[model samples]
Each structure stands twice: as structure tokens, then as C-alpha cells.
Target: MDRPTRWTRATVYPDMWVDPADDPRNSDGVSPDGELPTLVDYLGRYRATLLMKCDDLDAEQLARRSVPPSTLSLLGLVRHLAEVERDWRGWITPGAVPPRLYGSADGDFEGAAPDPSLVARAFADLAREQAATDTALAAHPDPGERLGADGIAVRELQVHRIEEYARHCGHADLLRECIDGRVGQ
Candidate 1:
């Protein structure tokens, strides 16, 4: 039996998954102006990068736990990020308190089975949650504006979200590479 050729970090350019010019995560020539715009841009780019990593993969590929001892998958990441977005919305909106989308804290990963419907639902949930969170964030034009009873600044939460996305995006890159040899920006 013959195996398919798989590209690895050694075969590809060092550190980059794609060419810089062709990378979808690349920001346009215009830089984001303020703190809020910068934060939002970073978050948005990370989200897109995660999606790009999952693109062209089947449900089984998306849900494959390529890394041993870890239940992490591209599908799981999608579900987990959706939960995170919803949680962030609840944190910022007093009395919102949205229930967990996947029931248990680890349900996102544990329940990430290789089913097309499940994969579709995960993506849908992520998109809806992201839109809702963005809308909630839009209500606070001022980054310094305090939110919720804990009175965390909008800027603080935004920065945290960006950090979360950045971490997960790195995970997605590795998972994607494991699933397929495809690597670039």
C-alpha cells in the first residue's frame, strides 16, 4: 500500500502555513485605528484563521483526535469557541446569563463526534454566537466603559477574547496539519 505525500514544517517554509501575500488572515494595508478596532481586528483574524484551517476537511477529519491524550479537534475548537463567545456575552451583559451551549464544560470536546450534522451545527452555533457577541460589544463604543456587576472594562474583555482566539488558532494550525499535509500562512 502506498501513502499519500504529506507536507510538513520541514517541507514548507519555516513557521508559515501559507504565503504572506496569500494568507487570508492578513490585514489590509489600512491598520486598525484605536484600541477597540485593533482588538476586534485581531479577534476577527484569528476566528477566520481557525475557519480556514477547518476548510476542505470532512466531518471525520474535522473531528479526528490526531493528538493522543488530548480530545482536541477542529470541530471541538469550533464548538468550544462558540461557548466562549456566548460566555463572554453573558459576562458583559448584566442579567444575560446565557446557559452553556454544550451542557458540560468539556462537552464541546467530548461530544465532538465525526458526524456531518454535528459539524454543521457547530459551525452554525459559532457564527451565531460570534454575531451576537459582536452586537453586544457594539453597544459599548468606549473601550473604557465598564460592564457587568464585576465592572470589568470592555477593553479588558476584548483583549482576553483576542488572547483566547490566538491560543486556539495555534492549536487549529497543528490539528489541521495533522489531518492533512496542507500548510502555509
Candidate 2:
């Protein structure tokens, strides 16, 4: 038996890279397609990119904090994003509580390390949080509807989520590169 290749095997061809104008799904939707009309689509696509960036990495690789003085890793990002989704839900939909997936606010980034179990838990929590956020968003389809204690519009919040994921995804790029010389979208 042979050990599998690590991050070096994850590859992206030139055509597969995400284009700025194109929707993240990599395909035009329908004839005269209306485009992704909601924040969910945009943010969800960004989240997919983040996950794609980490695909095939082992727990040690995922949890490797390549950047010094910063506790940022792909695993940490997954945990952080899960908490972020829950926080946003709390802001917009008061009295409708979802159990906090990652425990404390800073715990996501704090406790993460190069451990397989912790890394697996991070990914699991991310998936659960994403599902919950989708459910909450579906309950109110109209993006124009004002939600959250700050009266933040759902659309704007969704865009913010996209921005958040996009930024962290960039971080993941650098971290992944540092960890194993892998690069690109």
C-alpha cells in the first residue's frame, strides 16, 4: 500500500478559474438567464470557492497556520465562517435562535490547531452553519425586507457575507500556498 499524494494533487486548469463577471457556478443559468438574484447565490458561490480551495487537504494541512502571528488557517476559516453565519442570523432574526456551532466567539480561531479531529469538526460545523443560514434566508425571500437589529437589509447582509468569504478565501489561498506550494483558484 502507498500513501496518497497530498496537496500537490489538487489542480485547477486555466478554464476552471472563476471569472469576475461570471457567476461562481461556472455555467450560465438559463436562456435569457436572470442571473443570481439573491445574496445567497453570491455568498454561496464564494463559500464554494473557499471549500474548493481546501479540497483534498488532510487535517494537518487544513489546520496548518502557515502565517505567523496570525491564527488563520483553512480549518480556522471554516470554523470562523460558521460562527459568522450564526452571528448574522442573530443580528437579523432576533428571538429565532440557532445553537452556536463553534462555542465561543473567538474559540474558532483560538483553539484550532494541526489536529485531525479539530479540523474535521471545523468542516462539519461549517456545513451545519451554512445549512442553517440557507434555511433562514429561504424563510424570507425578499432581499429588500429589512432584518436585523441594525435594520440591515437582507440583501446587503448577504453581500457582506460574500465579501467576508471572498476576503478569507484570499487568506486561504496564501496559507495553502505556503503550506504546499499549491496555487491558483
Candidate 3:
């Protein structure tokens, strides 16, 4: 039996690939003028990077667990990120964070099965949640603006969003590499 050749994706830069066209999310010349926009731009770039890692992979590949003691997968990442978006967006409001997207006790990871339907739903959820979050942030031009009874600063949350995306994108990179040799920043 012969193994198939798995080609590692070639990137034009450490942070981006030379795809059919340039990946706009590769942080190409991301010149953010203000703090809020900077944070938003970073978060958006990481979000796109995560999706790029999962691009063109099948459901099974997306759902491949990281290792024996973990259930982390690209699908899990997608679901988890969606939940993260939902939660943080909720926090932007004074009210309690809305109910989590996945009600399962195991959290978003449990719903991360290798099914095309799940993949579709996860992406849709992320898009809708991101749009809502962006709208919420857009209402607050000043990053110093505070919200809620506890007075959580919008800047803190935006920066936190960027951090969260960055961390998850790191995890996603490993998962993607494990699924295939394809590696990129």
C-alpha cells in the first residue's frame, strides 16, 4: 500500500499563503488608525486565519482530535469561537451574557461532530455573532467607553477578543497541521 502525498501549503509570507488570490485576512497592510480599530482589526485577522486553517478540509478532517487526551479539533474550534463571540457580545451589554449557544454541559466541543451540517452551522453562527458584535462595538467609538453595572471598558473587551482569537488560532494551527501537513501563520 502506498501513502498519498500531502502537500504542505506554500505561503507568500509567514502570515499568509499564496492562494488563488491573496487572503485579505492575512493582515496585509492592516493600518488601524485608532485603538478600537486596531483591536478590531487584529481580532478580525485572527478570525480569518482560523477559518483559513480549516479551509478545504472535509468534515472528518476538521473534526480530528488533537491527541489522545484532548477533544480539540478544528470543528471544535469553530464552535468554541462562535460561543466565544456570543458570550463576549453579550457582555458588551449591561445585561447578563445571553445563554450559551450550545446548552450541552460539555460546552461547544461536544457538538463538534464530524458532520457537514455542523460545520455549516458553526460558520453561520460565527458570522452572525461577529456581525452583531461589530455592530455593538461600532456604537462605541471611544474604546474608553464603559458599559454595564460593573463598568466594563469596551477597550478591555475588544482587546480580550483579540487575545481569545489569537490563542484559539494557535490551537487551530496545530490541529490543522495534524490533520494535514499544511502549515502557515
lDDT agreement of model 1 with the native: 0.87
Tens digits of per-residue lDDT for model 2, 22-136:
4245656643322335455567668888987787788888887755788888888888998898887887787866666766767888777888888777788788778877788
Clashing residue pairs, backbone N/CA/C < 3 A, model 3: none
What pairs collide in candidate 1?
Answer: 17-183, 17-184, 17-185, 18-184, 18-185
- Runs of candidate 1 with Cα error greater than 4 angstroms are 1-15
Question: Candidates 1 and 3: which is better by TM-score?
Answer: 1
Candidate that scores best on TM-score: 1
Error of 2 at 174 (Å): 0.6
lDDT (Cα, tens digit) per residue for candidate 1, span 1-185: 33335563323355676666667777668888998998999888888888988988999999999567999999999999999999998888878589999999899999999999999999999999999999999999899999988898999999999899889988887787777766655
Report RMSD (Å) for each prediction in the order shown: 3.0, 5.3, 2.9
- Give the candidates in order of TM-score, highest first: 1, 3, 2
Q: Model 3 over residues 1-185: C-alpha lDDT tens digits?
A: 33233454554444434453576664445488878777887887788888888899999898888877787988888888788888777776876668888887456887789889988998899889888888888899888999766678999888888888899888987777677766667
How does residue 44 of candidate 1 score in lDDT?
Answer: 87
Top lDDT hit: 1
Question: Candidate 3, 153: how far from true, in Å?
Answer: 0.8
Which parts of model 2 have CA positions greater than 4 angstroms off?
1-24, 28-38, 96-100
